[model samples]
Target: MKYFLWLLVSVALAGSISSCRSTKRIQTAISKKDTAAVVPVVDAKADSMRFIHEIYQAIERNRIDFNTFSAKLKVDFSGDEGKKRDFTAVLRIKKDSAIWVSITALLGIEAFRIMVTPDSVKVLNKLDKVIQLRSVSYLQELAKVPFTFQELQALLIGNPVFLDSNIVSYRKNEKTISLLSATDIFKHLLTVSTDDYRLLHSKLDDVDVLRARTCNIVYGDYVNKNALLFPTYRGITVSEKTKVDIVMQFKQVDFNVDLTFPFNIPRNYKRQ
Candidate 1:
């Protein structure tokens, strides 16, 4: 139960290869911001190799090129036991630097403040006045995902988080490209838009099959921010021993913006 919010925080915490000639050219087009709302022309007779190239190009095009990002989000969460809650959250990310979040509940009271970096994770429970300082491994244990801070940042920013470069199989349809990979512990499915290569959805299921643990994420509402497309809305669902669903909508978004990360544990606060 103590790990509940970490899973949610991981969502808020905010890949791959090549193909043939035409696909390389398409990447150049995307980087130049020439293809606004342009969907690539899918070849009906394309083979797995060609399709792989196209998929990689699209994935590359969707990568967010930003030094810093800050957003005010409306966060809603629900659980399998019919519990619901809402909080106003401020999310700040410095590319490859850190992710800082402040969650406010009733009357604008800050209930929790968390800061995660490449090396450590810090959480201050304002309600209990307890501070939890943990190593990055603690988070890996809590979430049961072999992810780094960079991976969480990618997830929050609507980018592909964990895609196996050596894909076993893939399916390409009119609107989406789906890639699949199987490991001993988890099976991963990543789906991206056929048009812009923006990630449309991602899912991870426990290989235990009988245990029924999974994490699903969906990205939507792409908005152009200085010629770069970013998702304005995100939905994450994780089902394990406990079920948690989180939805985040960016009310205001800014990029390459000057930001301050303020995290001060109170002097009287006890460390947990």
Candidate 2:
């Protein structure tokens, strides 16, 4: 009876836990009519500013209930030009709250999954046929993700991605706002093109090297479904003395999808 209950719950959360956002609303927002209206305006800069503010205000005002998302990633680090290390992987994010959900990454010949709730985290590796579970606070230290949960949530919600928002500083002008956030880990400045609200450039200060590097993170396409905008392509280039470039092309994403925790282990699967 317990096994049956667990299956029923997992099925509800995992099936169609995937959904695409609504694109029609985005068409309405950026319609040809809106663009046409701006062509004749004299205070064109002001008008564009207002329009972008309204758009971003809408984005900020809007709420996201992103229960699940799918992403494809291509990561490359280029301190050395002699070799290029690359891999293709798909990841599924399932979250019920700020402290709960699952992340499953599928790579060639291996399946790695992590389930984190308020209390505990469980990592499952199908290739090794082992399951490891531990307390949440302890697991946070063990996590190897490039960013923290807060950062991930921000990215997932289509908001400005910052490693630390609490200490960020900002300066605004008619055309742009330069924001700087610093920590012992790293420091960076972000310039947002006011008319577009798109980040024009981001620069990170390298403490050890006693220098600065400009970072380029570009948004390629956004798909809007059900009042949410999702970026489909992302490219980032790190400019030090040398340049390292990485690009990610997303195949699909579903937000506000179902996510539930599993309550039972299959008899065949090993638990550790």
Candidate 3:
């Protein structure tokens, strides 16, 4: 049951966000879009700014500024022990504060509970009757990559994560817009819908040829939540030494409603 519960944690919050630069030219180009030609203009400065504006606008559109978020999810897990399993999870989050998750297994049995804050993380393993307390670095250890609490929260709320604002070039098509950036270790690519600017996909690959690894996340089935559009379904695949695929479907979601986060460990439970 420890392995089973850890799978939920690893998949739920294993990624991080990346950071951006110039504003004058970009702002001028954005303001001139009304007068610019419609037939795919060849001006490099104008086009680059246009692409940047599109991505920037999309990120803003997908942003969720709620004080609290609570959702019920139907999660399907694969690539763990080469077997598949389904679990129901209730996720509660307070913006920039903490994240609380409860996983229910067969027969609605509560198997695991997780609480993560800016400074620490706590896991209650009901099956083993043990609990683990660790610092924020626990996420980095679990994913074998640098990640933060806010990045995980952004991903959960369907906002853009791990995006680089230093994008100077882009590829555009009728259906999608692609942005690329290279870091010391990874080359990242992000694609979005040209129609509504919703995030379609994001891919990251190790730059070194000797080290082959990739992480891909896809968002779909967008729906409106109080004038804000959010993805209802998300698929995440991480390929490193091994491959893990996680599918999440949000059955219900509520934002900024009164809620409580309860976490209590039994006295008899052991600590590890």
Candidate 4:
């Protein structure tokens, strides 16, 4: 049951132990030759600032806003030991309030039901008939990094996490733009489409060089619904000592819909 909980939280707080390949690619892209004639240093600096501002604006323009969000998801998880598990999950969230999830295993048997809020974490394990409740800090402990309910909510809803405006550099290709920003906690490299500014990928590394923690996220298969563009698929890779991969495909999704979070522990279940 503890392992199961760890896997769930790890997926929500995705990071990676992967190499710095993406960083190298961005550096290479920035140094690529430009066919356009060179301009004065002052004008070039102005153009760079304008470009950065435009990118920030585009990100804000595409941010998802809602009162409530719900989705049916198909999740595939691969662990470090080469074990794989596939399950279906129903997720519901109230903005800045709560997140509820139900995971079902083979033969439609409900395996776990979880509810997380600003202050606490609760889990009901059907297979073991146990209930585990702990303070919100438990999530941070499980992920080995500071985490918050708001960050988890944003991750599930396809919003960028750990993003900062202190952009140090940017690189652009014909189709995509990559911005690298550094903050106290993370060095975040974010990539978005040139045409619509839809998120394409994100790579994060801990600012402290010795920690050796990294995460990579990819977004794809966007669909327009209710006048909003949403990504239906996400791929996450988190690594430090070991690697864990998670893929989420949204089978159905809706926003600003009335919802309920039902969490009732069975009387006979033992508290762990």
| TM-scores for candidates 1 onward, in order | 0.81, 0.51, 0.82, 0.85
Best-performing candidate as measured by lDDT? 4
Q: Candidate 3 — worst ten consecutive residues by lDDT sum? A: 14-23
- What local lDDT does model 1 show for residue 166? 60
> Model 1, 190-266: lDDT tens per residue?
77767668777666666675776666666777789878788887767666677666667786888998999999988
Question: lDDT per model, in order?
Answer: 0.69, 0.43, 0.68, 0.74
- Global local distance difference test of model 3: 0.68
lDDT of 3 by residue, 46-70 (tens): 7578767767667676677888989
Once superposed on the true structure, which residue ranges of model 3 sit more than 4 Å away at CA?
A: 1-46
Q: What are the per-residue Cα lDDT tens digits for candidate 4 across 1-272?
A: 45545754564542111122232232232211310112112222567878887898899889998899898998777777888877788989999998899988789988989999999999999999999999999988997767878778878888887677887667787887777777777767777889888887777776665766767677777888777788887777776778777677886889998999999999999999
What residue runs in model 4 are displaced by over 4 Å at the alpha carbon?
1-45
In model 3, what are the clashing residue pairs, if there are any? 17-162, 18-162
Q: Model 2: per-residue lDDT, tens digit, 195-215?
A: 545433333444344434334
Query: Model 3: number of clashes?
Result: 2
- Give per-model CA RMSD: 10.0, 12.8, 9.9, 6.4
Clashing pairs in 1: 14-152, 14-153, 19-53
TM-score quality measure for candidate 4: 0.85
Sort order, TM-score high to low:
4, 3, 1, 2
TM-score of decoy 3: 0.82
lDDT of 1: 0.69
As for lDDT, the candidate ahead, 2 or 3, is 3
